[model samples]
Target: MTEDFYCDEVLSDKIQVRKVLETDNVLAYYHTKPFWPVHVVAIPKKHIPSLITLEESDNELLLELLRVIKKVATMVTEENGACRVITNLGDYQDSKHLHWHIVSGEPLKQLFNERLQ
Candidate 1:
C-alpha cells in the first residue's frame, strides 16, 4: 500500500458495492460475502497494504474509524446480542487493503469463538 494506488483497476471486480462514503484517503462500505448477518468493510481509501504499515499520522483517522465501529457494533448487537470486529493482515487476510470487517449475529459469535481457539 505504500506504493501508488489504482482503484478502478484494482477493485473493479472485487467489490459488489456501489454505495460508499469516500474521503480523500479512505473508503467505507458494506461487504458482499457477509460472514454474519450484518457485515461491512471500513477500509482506508489510501493504499497502505496492511495494518502493519500504519504510521503515527494514521492514528487520528484510525481512532475515528474505531468510533464508528463502536456505534455500528452497538446497533448490530442491540438486534443480535453480539457482534465481531475483525481486522485481518498478511497471508491470513484475503484482501490486501487494510479494512475492518464488522459483523454480528448469534451464529457469527459462535464462529468467532471457535476460530479464537
Candidate 2:
C-alpha cells in the first residue's frame, strides 16, 4: 500500500469508494476493505498526514471531519444499537492518512488475524 491511500487512491480517483457524506473539505465513505460489518471512513479532502500532524490552521477542517464522523456514527448506531469511532496512530496507522472509522457490530476476526501477521 502507498503511504497515503486516501490521496493516492480515493481522492485521486484511482480507487472508487461509496461515499456516505461529502463536503468541500471532508469526505465520508465506506471502507474499501472493511474490518467491521458496518465500517465507514471519514477523512479530510486535503492531505493531512495524521492526527498528530494537524496544525492550528486545520482546526476548522478537523471539526468538519468530526461532524461527518458523528453523522455516520449516529446512522450506524441507530441501526445497530451501538458503534465505535476509532483512529490509529504511530505504528498502528497503516494508511498514514488522518481518518476516523465509524463502525458497528463485532469485528471480523479473520481480518484482524490477517493484519496481525
Candidate 3:
C-alpha cells in the first residue's frame, strides 16, 4: 500500500461506513462508493496489514468473513438483482485492514482502479 493509502484514506469511522451489520470478526457495511448497484464492504476491525499477513488466529475471522460475504451476496442478489464481489491485496490493497469489497451490477473495476491509482 502506498503511504497515501491506508484505512484512514477511505471511510474513517463506523459511522462513515453506512450501518450494515457487525459479526464477531467482521464488520459488514455499505460502501461509500457504490461501485455496483449493490456494493458493500465486509471489513475486519483488526488492523491487519494485508491479506498475506493474516495469521492462523485469523481463521475464525476468515470464516466469519466468508459467512458475511454469503449473507451480503444473498441480500444483494435478492434485493438488487446484482451479483459482484471484490477484495484487493498487496499492491492492489489500499487499506491496512482486511476488507472484502462486495459489489453487484455494472462494471466497476476500471473506475475503481483508476480512482485508486
lDDT of each residue in 52-82, candidate 3, tens digit only: 8889998887888889888888888888776
C-alpha lDDT score of every prediction, in listed order: 0.66, 0.92, 0.72
RMSD of model 1, in Å?
5.7
After TM-score superposition, the amount by which residue 38's alpha carbon in candidate 3 deviates from its true location, in angstroms, is 1.8
Candidate topping TM-score: 2
Clashing pairs in 2: none
Q: What does candidate 2 score on TM?
A: 0.91
lDDT of 2 by residue, 1-117 (tens): 579999999999998899999999999999998889999999999999899999999999998998898889889989999999999999999889899999887789866787999
Q: Where does candidate 1 have its weakest 10-residue lDDT segment?
A: 1-10
For candidate 3, give the lDDT of residue 113. Answer: 80
Query: What's the CA RMSD for each of the models?
Result: 5.7, 3.4, 5.1
Look at candidate 1 and give me any clashing residue pairs: 1-47, 1-49, 26-45
Q: Identify the runs in model 2 with alpha carbons over 4 angstroms from their true place.
A: 110-117
- TM-score, every prediction: 0.67, 0.91, 0.74
